[model samples]
Target: MDFSTLCVHGCSKRYDTTGSVSVPIFQSATFVHPGVGLSTGFDYSRAQNPTREYLEQTVANLEGGADAIAFSSGMAAITTLMEIFSPGDHIIATDDLYGGSHRLFSHISKKNGLTFDFVDTTDVQNIKKCIRNETRAVFIETPTNPMMHVTDIAAVSKLCRENSLLLVVDNTFLTPYFQRPLQLGADIVVHSGTKYLGGHNDTLAGFIVVSDAALAERLRFLSKTTGACLSPFDSWLLIRGIKTLAVRLERQQQTAFRIAEWLSKQDKIRKVHYPGLPSHPGYEISKKQTSGFGAMLSFETDSKETAHRILERVSIIQYAESLGGVESLITYPMLQTHADIPQQEREARGIGECLLRLSVGLEAADDLIEDLRQAIYGGKANV
Candidate 1:
């Protein structure tokens, strides 16, 4: 089935009890066993839930994976995957990554005896040189957060396959609707369902899709044992949100392209980083890998004061950290999403205090551009 059809009809079925087209949320905490010797499919809500199962199955199918597991948050899914490696194991990850994921790899994982080396994965040779005998996984996020750097997924996946290392790709920026990492040879695909998968800011959830059945089983065990399973209600919401993903993402992508183009022509903007922009460094690779340019974009201003002034002046876009929602959001990466990283390290990666990240929404292209234009020019005109 095509992606559009799968969005609406995948893993969702009408039931007699509700007599409704929408899948009913099974909110019960536990399921009854059939008898002493026999048991139903679900024994407890924490271990399994009908709604979450439907969501997991749908995500797995969309990503072309054997199975899927849902977690409380994106970090929960990531930490669970990290658990597959033992102490003294090393990981090679992209230097430009989601701040939260970077924190886990650099700080939290270190305490657990996991070591990480951050390198620019866009240069495949550099990534190969960073791998060591102790390396267990290659963590990648194409079109990385804030910087919008695109890593070659297939190249890294091939390297991992040759070296007997796991390749984990964070697919949050371009959801399965736009890019399927598993189809590109990735071993595991991770998502912050709170973003595009949910298509709204109401729910916080995470999902992992893996082509290997054994890895799926291991993730299931870790999910149940660690108690990071997603709640039934949130899972139901995610299911509903995913049904309209194609439609929502299409509109959001259009807006993003327009905004990115307009931002590039602005005098106050020093540089615009968006895969859709023809001048973008990863434009060719992005076209080869993703079906569409995603809804996230970033631009650098002349100064930190100018960036903050624009952020404070914008009326239509909200000042928020999360992205991939129906509504537009603007964030100062240095202080908001990437604040956890040390100053020197962020500077080394070219993430400056003057850089602003925007998650474009399904709004009128002209209105969004006007709002941004005014924010940047209005403050100075008044001054």
Candidate 2:
């Protein structure tokens, strides 16, 4: 089936004989067994739930992975992922990432005895330079959060294979609709399904997809032990959200491209970072590996004053955090997404106070442009 069809219809599996169009939420925390020693394939919600399972199967199918495990939120998925390595294991990760991930690695993971080297993975050579004998894996967020720095996943994956390392790619921004990291040789694909997969900003969810059954089993064990699995109701919400994923993203990408073009032409905007633009440093690599340039974008204003004004003025385009939803949002990474990183380090990574990240949504392009224009120029179309 085409991806569009898959998004709408999902797999052929039916949850019940009722023939309901939606996956039913198995609200029970524990299930009744048919026999003393036998089971009905489900025992408890902590281990698994029918609704969450259906959502997991759908995500696995979309990413073309062997299996996908769902979690309460993206952080929960990532926190559980960290358990795969023991104390003293070192991991190389992209310098620019969601602030939560950085906080986890720097504060929590380090205290737990895991060390991390944050490098600009846009150049696979940078990642290569960071690799040490203790480095067991590489974690990457392509078209990285706030910076929009696109990494060559295939190249990094090849390097990982050569060095006997696990390559984990955070596919949150692009989602499987635009890019499937597993197909590009990623050992594990992680997502903040709360973003694109959920489509609406109504529920929190996360997933980790792996191509190896052994890895899948390991992750499942960890997730069950942690007890951070998604609830049946939230899983159902995600299932419904994904039904319109294809259409929502297609419309969002179209609007984002238009908005990026507009931002690039503004004198107040210093530079626009979007892979869809031909001038982007990783444009060619992104084109080679992904089917589409996603709806996420970031721009650096000429001054911190300009960035603040835009954030305060926007009305229709909400000034908020989080991305990939039906409503467009503008965020200040310095204050919201990348604040966990030290000031000097954040600026060194090119995430300055003047930078603003935009998450294009289902809004009409022209309306969103007008909102931004008024926000930037203070009631004027352009300054």
Candidate 3:
């Protein structure tokens, strides 16, 4: 079946008991066993739930992975992956990562005795140089947050394979609709389903997809042990959201391309970071790795004051941290998302005070541009 058809009708089936078209929310925390020696595949909700299982299977199918585990949040999924390694194990990751993930690596995991080295993974040679005998995994986020830097997944995966290290790719920005890292040889693919997979801004969910059955078993066990399983209700919502992912992303990507082009022309904007833009540094690499350029874009205003004023003036676009929703969201990463990082570190990564990240929605291209124009011009005049 085509991806479009699968979105509407994928894992949803009516049962004889309820006769409901939507996948019923199995709200029970524990399922009854047939007998003392028999089991029904699901013994407890923490370990598994029918609704979450549906979502897991659907996401696994979408990403072309053998199995998937849904988690309470994106960070939870990432934490579970980190759990696979011990205190002394080393991890090589991209320098410009999601702020929350950076916090986890720099603070939480560091406290736990895990060592991490952040490098520019876009250059495979740099990544190769950073790898050590103790390095157990390579973590990468392509079209990296804020900067939109693209890394060659295939090159990194090949490096990890040769060294017997795990390769984990965060596919939150692109989702499975735009990019499948497993096909590019990544060992594990993670998503903040709260973003694109949820579509609406109402739910927070995460997922991990693995091609290796052995690794799947380990992750599933870790998820169960940590009690980070996604709620049945949220799982149902995620499943529903995923059905329209293809269409929603298609429209969102189109709007993003238009917005990127428009933002590039603005005199107040210093630079636009979007893969769809021809002048973007990662445009060529993105063209080879992703099916589409995605809907997230970031630009720097003339100064910090101008950036804040523009953010305050925008009426339609909300000033929020999260992305990949139907409604447009604007965020100051250096303040909202990456605030925990020291100023020096953020500046080193090019996440400046004037940087504004925008997650394009399904809104009309002209309307969005007009809203941005008014906000920028009005804010500048007021200043």
Candidate 4:
């Protein structure tokens, strides 16, 4: 079936008794067995829930993975994935990432005894140079947050294979509708389902999808042990959100491309970071791997003053954190998403104080463009 078809029908179960299209939420904490010493597949909700199981199965199908596990939040999924390695294991990761991820690796994971090397993954050589004997994995975020740095997944995966390392890709920006990292040789694929997969900013969830059976088993065990499984209600919400992934992303990306083009032409804007733009460094490479350029983008103003003005003035496009929803959101990386990284490191990564990331929504392109214009120039659209 086509991706659009899969969005609605893939891996979804029908109610045998009621023939309900929606996957019912099995809200019970524990299940009853019919006989002594007998049991159902789901003995406890912590281990499994019918609603969550359907969500897992649907996501697994979407990503072309052997299995998928849902979590309470994106960070929870990532934390659990990291637990597969012991204290001394090191990882090579993308330099520019979501602030929360930076916090996890730098502050929390380090205390747990895991070390990380952050590098510009757009160039495979950086990853190659960072690979120490103790390096167990390469964690990457293609079209990386704020910067829109696109890494060559297949190239990195090849390097990982040669080095006997796992390649984990965060598919949050593009989701399965636009990009399937597993198909490009990623050992593990992760997502902050709170974003595009949830479509509305109404719930929080995460996912770990993988093709390797052994790896899947390990993740399953860790999920159950950690007890961070997504709630039945959230799972149902994600299922509903995913049903429109294809259409929502199509509209969102269309608007994003227009916005990026407009920003590039603005005098107050110094640069635009968007994979969809031909001038972007990652444009060609992104074209080769992903089906679409995605709705997330970032741009740098001529100065901090101009960025501040836009942030304070935008009326329709909200000034906010978090992305991939029905409403457009603007975020300041220096203060919001990448602030956890040290100032020196953040500057080195090119996420300066002037940078602003935008998550385009299903809003009309012209209206959003007008909103940005008035916010930046404080005038009505003349053209």
Candidate 5:
């Protein structure tokens, strides 16, 4: 069977008891025991829920991982994974990263005695040079947030293997359908399922998929201890969301490529950051590894005023935070996504006031293109 089939029937066995096509939400907080000192493979909601398990198993299969864990939010999944390291451990991370992850690493993890070094992972040498004896893991976000810098996951994974370091890849921007990092030698894969995997902005969820059983066990223990598991209702919602991932992403990617090409030709646009475009820096590398270039892209204007005007003027594409929904969204990275980083650091990363990230959705290509035209030029497109 293909990806769409797996999305719908990957974990159907979990619903064998009810014989229902839709997985029922196991909403109970606790399970009953049949006899003394006996169990039914589940005892509490924090440890496991049937609905969450179905979603987890399906995701694990899709990502080619031994196990998958679900969380209340993307941050929760990352925070729980961070607990695997002891105090004073060091991590090498992508320089351009999600603001929430940066906050967790710069402040929260540092305070807990863990240290991190940020580098451009796209250049394997940058990561190789930064490795220290205390470096336990190399964390990266390929096609990094706001900047759209693509890292060579296989190359970095090789370096990690040589140094006896774990390779953790954040696959949020391109879900398993587009790219599966586990097959590229990454030890663990993480995602903000609230974005692509959920396929809608209505629910929040996160996932951590691992090929190594030992790593999966440790993460599961941390998830249970932290008690940040996704609720049964939200898990059911994610299941429905993922069932449409194949079709939704295809339409979204098509419109994204069309919009990116159009943006590149505009006089007001200074630069476009989309892997699907031939002119994009990551185009060749992206084609070599991932099955498809994802829908997320970022662009810059000639001036901050132009960016602000377009964001304010756009009618069809909402100016908002978060991405990967059925509806198109345009976001100002400097103030919205990367605001947590220090001003100097954010500017140094090339995430300036003129940069704007766009998450293309299921909207028609012509309508989306026209929306950008009117927003940037403040006039009819002469269609």
Candidate 6:
């Protein structure tokens, strides 16, 4: 079946015989036992819910993975994933990461006895230099958060295979619609389903999809044990939201390319970091790995004052945190996403006051550009 069709119909296994088009939410906390020696396959909501199960099947199907587990949030899924490694284990990860992920690694994961090395994963040689005897896994967010640095998944996966290490890829920015890391040989694929998968700012959900059923079982054990599984209602929302992922992302990226091109020509903009543009360093690799350039892009203003003016004055795009929703948002990386890192380190990583990340939405290209024009020129929105 086509991916778009699969997104709508999923595995076509029905729990209830009601023949309902929309999967019904099994909102009960626990299920009644069919018999003393038999089970209905679901004993409690914490272990599994029929609605969440349906959604998980769809997500696994989308990624071409053997199985998947849904979680309350992306961080919860990641934290649970870290449990697979024992104390004294070391991991290597992308330096340009989400603030929350960095906080988890630096403060929590480090304190828990696991050591990590942060490096630029775009060059496989950089990753090779950081490997040590204790290294257990490599975690990366391709087209990395805020900076938009793309990594060659196939290259990294081959390296992991040679070392017998697990390779995990955060497929949030591109989603399954644009890229499938599992198909590229990643052992695991993580997603903030609250973003493009949900396609709305209305719910929070996460997923961990694995090509190996054994790995899926292991993570699922940790998931239910931690009790952060996605709620039945949020599961339904993600299901509905994913049904339109194909169309939503197509429109979003179309406008994104237009805006990225326009920003590159603007005098106030210093540099635009969008892979869709030929001038981007990652453009060729992105074309090789992803079907689309994705809707997320970041740019640097000529000065911090211009960046502040655009954030304060933009009317069409909301000046807020978070991305990959129907509504466009512009956020300051220095203050919003990468603030957990020290100022000097953050600046060295290319996240400075002049940098602004934009999540392009379903807005018309010309309107978004004009709104940017007014904001950049110091005119009022009403003017």
TM-scores of all predicted structures = 0.97, 0.98, 0.97, 0.98, 0.98, 0.98
**What is the C-alpha lDDT profile of model 5 across 154-221, one tens digit per residue?**
99988999999999999999999999999999999999999999988999999999999998998999
In terms of lDDT, model 4 sits at 0.92
| Worst ten in a row by lDDT for model 3 | 10-19
What's the residue-level lDDT of 22 in candidate 6?
A: 92
- Each model's lDDT comes to 0.89, 0.92, 0.90, 0.92, 0.92, 0.93
Query: What lDDT tens digits, residue by residue, belong to model 6 across residues 47-127?
Result: 999999999999999999999899999988899999999989999999999988899999999999999999999999999
**Candidate 2, 48-103: lDDT as tens digits:** 99888988999999999999999999999999999999999999999888899999
Candidate 5 stretches with Cα past 4 Å from truth are: 380-383
Q: Given candidate 1, what's the lDDT at residue 274? A: 94
Relative to the true structure, candidate 5 reaches a TM of 0.98
For residues 1-383, write the lDDT of model 3, one tens digit per residue: 77777666665534237667788889989989999989888899999888888888888888889999999999999988889999899999999999999999999998999999999988999889988888999999998997899999998989899999999999999998889999999999999999999999989999999999998999889999999899999998997998899999999999999898888888999999998888987888888888999999999999888898889888888899899999999999998989988999999998988999999988788778888988988743211
Tens-place lDDT digits, model 4, residues 279-341:
888999999999999999999999998999999988888998899999999999889888778
lDDT of 3: 0.90
> What's the C-alpha lDDT at position 115 in model 4?
96
lDDT at residue 214 of model 6 (Cα atoms): 89
Q: Mind giving the per-residue lDDT tens digits that candidate 1 earns over 157-251?
A: 89999999999999999998889999999999999999999988999999989999998998899899999999999998999999999999999
Q: Where is model 6 more than 4 Å wrong at Cα?
A: 380-383
lDDT of model 2 at residue 224? 95
